[model samples]
Target: MSTSSTGVLVLLGAPLGNPEDASPRVASELVRADVIAAEDTRRLQRLLRELGVSTSAAITSYFEGNESGRTEPLIEQLYDGKRVAVITDGGMPSVSDPGYRLVRAAIDAGFTVTAAPGASAVTTALALSGLPCDRFCFEGFAPRKDGERRRLFASLAEERRTMVFFESPRRVADVLRAMAAAFGGERSAALCRELTKTHEEIRRGGLGELAAGAESDPPRGEITLVVEGWGGPDPEDATPEALAAAVARLEAAGTDRKAAMKEVASRFGVPRREVYDSLIDRD
Candidate 1:
């Protein structure tokens, strides 16, 4: 697809670890590229070698730091109708990675943009998480700062869909600890590390349990976290035990017993008397 005015901008998904996992289409397209914009030139070289495909395409760096400056040149190639392929260190481009700019630029410039999809740590972790993957949201990476990360977790506390995030191994423990506080200790989650690599490990447990384990061992390598979403405390699931726990949680947050009972009653459509009985039973 190399020509003068109908240049196509292709987003290629690189293998997560095992190069043999790459699809045949990706290999063929790499050979067809007139310009290959890679997040890391060295990784690109290794991938090319492993795939055993030779390319005469002009290779250039396209990463977070140089995206703005590098995009126009790549767009120029596309404008010239040259087949341009964008590939990151791994996974599909334009994700939490740096290919979004080029994709947007190409679309804005009226160039056709497409993809040869492959492995993704997000979906991979979700599938392995054993959580409800029917509907989920990818949160990318949580903020590094404690306050910011906690705030982000709190905001997602009520989200009903499953959530995914990428995190650094160094901060996984802290993030899990914060998640337990914001999302509750019993919230189910999975910590997928070094995915698609030889040392790939997946740790599945409640947020509290994982946080405790991480503190002692501190996992290594790339980390992707899949967290169970908030299912919400609805009236239908309001068993006496559930109601009491909910009220106690509210009271612990400084709500008075009477008000907490009242709120729980209103929320669950249960009698204030039942809520009171549950609290009394706790005592």
Candidate 2:
């Protein structure tokens, strides 16, 4: 169905913390859209008020809860040749937010999709993180469950690229602790909270120090964490003997021998067989 574009699907970026960061293009799209899908209808109304623009667009909620249910209907609107605009609570519509499904459906149905980029927490936190940003990865949100969270951190322990993660205020400390456990207590990191807001704060330290500090002074507001990658030698760089010695340390710290070896293997991006061979040589 490569017919002429029936309608346009515009994804607008909302301000992260500062309303002034909202772009003119975003405002224009909001005012011009025939239909607007918002993560929160009330928040969208507030944004419209701040922008001082009245929109006649049909507004509907399209957050994670209703995203699946809303996609088809929104796609139908696009097929009807109606201009549809999407906005999230903050930042872009589909980055750790809803709207991806609708975007995909719109394109599948031959509608033209476009974006009006604006303020983003991912880049904003990375810039303020004081860590290497030239190469980095954004991990949408830290997993809330203990085992899953640790597994996630363990999987990325040896990642050479700096890592960014969005976390809840309540779980920030726990996440830092988990990272320390998986990536080593001395791994450097930065915690950014309430970015661009009046109460904005940036705390930088080793994972352990950050975890400890969070105990006495609980963090508040939206949280973004930036973690330095393993900048030292890669695991493969270690001599087999060195691998055995490292495994020994983990065991001494109460990690099971098998578990320790597995962790070492993951951190080094090496096969477990190599780590096992080192342990065999030690024996």
Candidate 3:
């Protein structure tokens, strides 16, 4: 068949691990694309081989380093009425990958942009996590520095939706510990490692337990963490004394009485005004 004359760019989702996860539409598009842009040309070739889809389209490398330089050329091809297909090393393109820039360029150039959506680690982990999926947020990866990581967690401290994050196995424990400290040790969470692979395993427990275990074992391979959202305060367990003590510590650390009361109230799941009144009465 002749190459498509419609200047459309397709973002194809590659298999995360299981080759069969490739959708039939992805396979057909692979066979029909006029040009293929891949994050890793070799990996894309291997995936195509596994799917038994042969393509005559010229393959070009478009990864993090050269994505900017390659976007215009790809856009030019798209402008010339060619079916340009973009695929990442694994999963869908532009998702923590290098396809977003090209997609944005194509859209700006008045070219049609679409995707043959398929397997995604974000949704896959959320589904198997057994956590509340009704509403959730994806935090791709935590910041590397400790201060930045802490600040990031602080910003999300009040996020109600179940939180999903991707982390390197090397730093999984560290991130978990930070989460435990920021979100509380008792927060329900699940740590998923090597998902969909032969060594797939999902460990569910309190953030404290998970953080300790992750540190002890040091998981390997891709890691996806699913953390339960704040379910209000643990009034049944947190005593008034405990809340007051927490407020004192915050106040000692230079936090204003009002802010300290708010933090303590949130930390202990009590009424902010009551905590404030208690502080005032004690003073």
Candidate 4:
């Protein structure tokens, strides 16, 4: 185990699908950690077996079900000068995974925080999707409920940057259909399935075409979707009221106020300061 002073919170990114894609540093971090916060303990075990590594670190379950409740004890571990490592089943923790609360808590508690970088479905798909990677946003997983999902889709309708989304095999077609309705069928997009593994596939087409194809032949793997941005005129024109309104929509959908404002700014192609000013004008 690595020497510990004030302790550290290591947010380790496990492989998305192929464990071999994991960085060399992952094995070393696995060894150095005093406590490992695994999103799926069984999955972590499989990963360890794949990597030919072993650790005596205490393993703890830290998935969505108990993320909030589990934060405090993890913080206490940090207080005790423990090298806490968080490894999700795939990708980086906190990007549509459990680890944000612990990270924020560690920062608030004045403990050092770091990450062992690894392959990400988000970037990997974006790179291979033939979409505009210069500006893009990860939308995480779309809402399961159609109403909320449609609302989210509508809220992002004006988003001009390339967009990426994660979806389950069961819901991939459903979300594609919803996107067809909200973003229109003609919107260009790519469906990247089983990325970085055997049987990996990247199907590119318009939203409508993809929706039809997915319905006819449902995808059967972890899916990451990359979509082209709006081709029409800028939605907000960076107006103060409109900027505030856009941020409000995202906040109403459970996004933090600051993050909502930042997203609004990115979508509208305006300075973040303008989004903040818009909020002030709203009051």
**Model 4 weakest 10-residue run by lDDT:** 230-239
Ranking by lDDT: 4, 1, 2, 3
Screening candidate 2 with a backbone cut-off below 3 angstroms (N, C-alpha, C), the clashing residue pairs are: none
CA lDDT, every model vs. true structure: 0.88, 0.87, 0.85, 0.90
Model 2 residue 232 distance off true place after TM-score fit, in angstroms: 3.1
What's the true lDDT of residue 181 in model 1?
A: 90
* TM-scores, one per candidate: 0.84, 0.86, 0.85, 0.81
Off by over 4 Å in 3: 1-5, 234-283
Alpha-carbon RMSD to native, per candidate: 5.0, 4.9, 3.8, 7.4
Model 3 lDDT, residue 258, Cα = 82
Model 1 spans with C-alpha error above 4 angstroms: 234-283
Candidate 4 lDDT by residue in tens digits, 151-208: 8897787688999999998998899999987777999999999988899999999999
**Root-mean-square deviation of candidate 2:** 4.9
Worst 10 residues of 3 by lDDT: 245-254
Tens digits of per-residue lDDT, candidate 3, 1-283, equal: 2355758999998888888989999999999888999999999989989999899997999999999999999998987888999999778898887899998898888888989998898888889889999999999889999977877776666578999998999899999999998788988899988777889899999999999999888889998999998675556756656566566655544667788788877777668877876766666
Cα lDDT for residue 115, candidate 2: 95
TM-score of 3: 0.85
Output the worst ten-in-a-row residue range by lDDT, candidate 2: 1-10
Better of 1 and 2 by lDDT: 1
lDDT at 38 for candidate 4?
96
Ranking by TM-score: 2, 3, 1, 4
Report the lDDT tens digits of candidate 2 across residue range 1-283: 1123477899999998789999999999898899999999999999999999999899999999999999999888877878899999999988999988988888888888999999999999999989999999999897788977876776677678999999998898898999998888899999999988899999999999999998889999999999999775565477897678667756655679899999888766788999999998889
